[model samples]
Target: MTVTETSATALHDDAVRTLEGWRTADAGQDRLRRDYLAHLAGHPDGLFRACLPAHITASALVVDPASGRVLLTLHPKVGIWLQMGGHCEPGDPDLAAAALREATEESGIPDLTLLTADGAPTPVMLDRHQVRCTGKDRPENTHLDVQYVALARPGAEALISEESLDLRWFGYDSLPELTDDSVRALVARARELTR
Candidate 1:
């Protein structure tokens, strides 16, 4: 389905309340807050809006089960190793679907499956971060983040997108050396949820 058509799923009330709290907490970023608010209003069940205090607008963590590794992208703007994800566009009906779309687009992995925290198709952790949304058009684009996790098989080849400078597979245990503390936390949380 088209991106806009896909992002129309309703969000839960708890998710809305969480998003509203973040908007109030980070009022300085008006444009970002407004855009996020608009996104939340559209999906009452999508909780990414509420869990955004962590520095993500939205995210998808792809794990490779065979190798016990995770697919990580070196974000061009943020300059860090992160999952394949971004803002929940108007067309992404829900966070899980959005994560899948991002995995396909960023990693060029076809038919990637999304798993839950419990190693099934379940909801994972919501990680947050702070980001300065740079570039020409988005002056007010600073981000408070919310992250999610998904699982894929090993040996899945990925085509790096412009958003990322590099893509690589890292063992879950060795991830600490390649990424920062926050990302490490995300990985740790994903591992816990998956375990």
Candidate 2:
């Protein structure tokens, strides 16, 4: 199925309504969404345009399954705890798969399931900021995010990578103290979906 069709099938009514509001607010938002879908479908190199006003692209989100606790990476540049995801490289097919792959690579967790493919793409509030890339052949660019959840196996341990200063699990009820408002919003949305 196409990204638009998949998104229509996966998102809940309330989420769809929220998206509609976003669509109405900016005419370009709907076109951007469609363009992103087309880009993901056609680009062999896995590049997409940022929704934000920058020339860079690609991003994702990761979620823990058993306890509904999110494994956040404390980014050294931003110094904020956020999801485990980044640019979709030349190999990634879709955003959801890329998110899962990034989570596993960054967290050292092998058993990650793509929630979006299972008809449950968790809504995530976007965070757009400037940061230098830390990956191999590091390039400076903006990140256009495609965020989603991944169901990690129970009792899995996350091996933090060098990109992150710290890796920790934060309960939904107690997420405020650990991160910024955008991260908290992602956690809240995940909790809403799980419950």
Candidate 3:
């Protein structure tokens, strides 16, 4: 059965199982992993962005394995270069699929391949950041981002989405100065996987 077709409850349960089984080498990441799991345990709507205060977000680092370049979106809201990804939809079947779906939509690049570990959509890394969407009464919210990597088809063209001010590819070693250390570390881990 397609579990995602059932209900939001299934999604939370699935997230719990996935996080519980994930193993990481980084001490900090392991702590974050536990935090993510705990968040899900406490918030049934944790996977959705509308969950106030904080929520889980899935993101993709679209990498061109043949060219050693990665796609980045200049986020219009945050005014920073970032990977393509955002809040999870109820239709998404799992975390990996959610990341892939977001990547495909934001990147507008077809035939991208999601790199997997042991045949699972295991995340390359996790990032937590604060965001405050513009407009009155929109308070600050925490984004618990689950970052994944995708192999962009060689020579694939990227189209900018409404969510970004610009979309461009940068060499792994040549990422723009506007990006934070989190993005740099994500690129580093993705590089190790691609190599």
Measured by TM-score, the strongest candidate is: 3
- Which is better, 1 or 3, measured by TM-score? 3
Clash count (model 3, backbone only): 0
Q: Which digits, one per residue and each the tens of the lDDT, describe model 1 over residues 1-195?
A: 554333433423333444444432334444555555565565443444333332235567887766778889988876778888776555555555666787789988886877642343433444435554545454343344445676676687777778788999888887735477767777776776566
The sequence of per-residue lDDT tens digits that candidate 3 reaches over residues 37-66 is 889988988998778888999999999979
Winning model by lDDT? 3
C-alpha lDDT of candidate 2 relative to the true structure: 0.56
Residues 11-35 of candidate 2 have per-residue lDDT tens digits of 3222223233333233544565555
Off by over 4 Å in 2: 1-61, 117-141, 176-178
Q: Record all residue pairs in model 2 with backbone atoms less than 3 Å apart, i.e. clashing.
A: none
Off by over 4 Å in 3: 1-5, 134-137
Model 1 whole-model lDDT (C-alpha atoms) = 0.61
> CA RMSD for every model?
7.3, 7.8, 2.3
